[model samples]
Target: MAKTIFITGASRGFGKLWAEALLQRGDKVVATARDLSTLDDLVNKYGDNILPLQLDVNDRAADFAAISKAKEHFGSIDVLINNAGYGLFGSIEETTEQEAREQMETNFFGLLWLSQAVLPVMREQGQGHIIQLSSVLGLVTLPVLGIYNASKFAVEGLSETLAAEVKGFGINVSLIEPNGFATDWAGASAAQTTAMPEYDAVRAAFQAGLTDDIFGVPEATTDAVLKLIDSENPPLRLFLGKYAQPWVKQTYEGRAAEWDSWSEIANAAHGK
Candidate 1:
């Protein structure tokens, strides 16, 4: 059976990779990019199997309209992949108001609005899947990726709550937490803040963490994504790449230890 899927940020990176995989497997994809021309190759190759739309995603009205159009074109949306987001590189002090807003607008609010738009359609259909493109950064933190980290943390919370709310409607929500991949995510697709001198050492530490070995080949993720989409019971959070788990494991372990360490004080502070 073929699925009717809608995906954002389909011009390149994980979005383009996943779109091609779905189309090749006979799924109908409503793919969106800021510039429709960016999707020309997919349109030409996939024919009517792909619907290319021009979407900035930050425009709530446009996103809702795009979702509605996709619903109409495909009859029912079986899956919605919210992959339209970029990385913002800056420490908390180095980041400006505009940059922070832009980060949240694209990564958090855009995904929120799109998810809301598709929910009604999924409700009508009685089943659907919403896969969000989060990052391993959502679960942990890095020095200079502060704003980017916050945006994904927002996404993780949002998707988790959405899953609980929509489970009764048979709509599944999943967060795809990818580790660093050789995608434009941190390259051409990324935005950077004007570096402040105070954070130079912090930036150096961040740079040191981003070794060549941490990034997986972007195309290598397609198979896992396809498997997730096809799953009868997909996970609420699916981690892509082997690099994500160990770090997340360490993060959780450290968190548990700190919480346990504070248990006495935590209990003592409870005046009640």
Candidate 2:
């Protein structure tokens, strides 16, 4: 069945590809960005079926209004993709307090509010899907991108809890974990490079590492997403590319072993 889908950060990158893909599958898409003018091709291609709107997920009021408007336009939202996020690449000591807060506000708090706004509607209707665009870093932390890791780690935690909470409400929550994609996420959307002199070598190495040669095709991930979205038994977490699978597996295994090793102390601390 063709459903109504709302995707944030639809102006470019994965969100843009997803919108086009969904529309090709005969679904109605409410594609939004901070600036709707950037969605010219979509508007020209699928005028009525694809509704373009201006949305800044960080703004609670505006987001609510946009959802309401989309509901009025498309009847109801069957799938909500929280894809509006950026990479803040810097060490913990280097990233300012303001930058950290902004990072959480956009990646964590903004997602929370949007999910909250959509919950009531989905609950009343008795079915909905919430998709989060998490990173491979959500499962594994690396040097120099501590703040970005923190934000995604927070999402992973919250999304896990939300999956359990909304199951009874007939709502589904899934996290999309993608590795290095040929998207502007690391290129155009990257945070300002600060604390340069302190970690010049590491910073330079990191910059040199982000190349399109290693990135996977965006369509492959989007195609996997389409399958995931349509599957009757969709996983709570979906790893997009082959590059991410090994990392996700290793992270889970390593973390599990570490936790198990500390289980005795953990239980003792809890007075078990």
Best model per lDDT: 1
The whole-model C-alpha lDDT of candidate 2 against the native structure comes to 0.88
- Where's the lowest-lDDT run of ten residues in candidate 2? 205-214
Count backbone overlaps in model 1: 0
lDDT of 2 by residue, 1-272 (tens): 99999999899999999999998879999998988888998889888999999888899998888889989888899989999899888777888888998888899888888898888889988999999999888988778889889999999999999999999988999999888888888778889647868788887888787675668888777778898789776799988777788877887998999999999899899864
Clashing pairs in 1: none
TM-score of each: 0.98, 0.93
Q: What is the lDDT of every predicted structure here?
A: 0.93, 0.88
lDDT of 1 by residue, 153-181 (tens): 99999999999999999999999999988
lDDT of 1 at 16: 88
Superposition error at 22 for model 1 (Å): 0.8
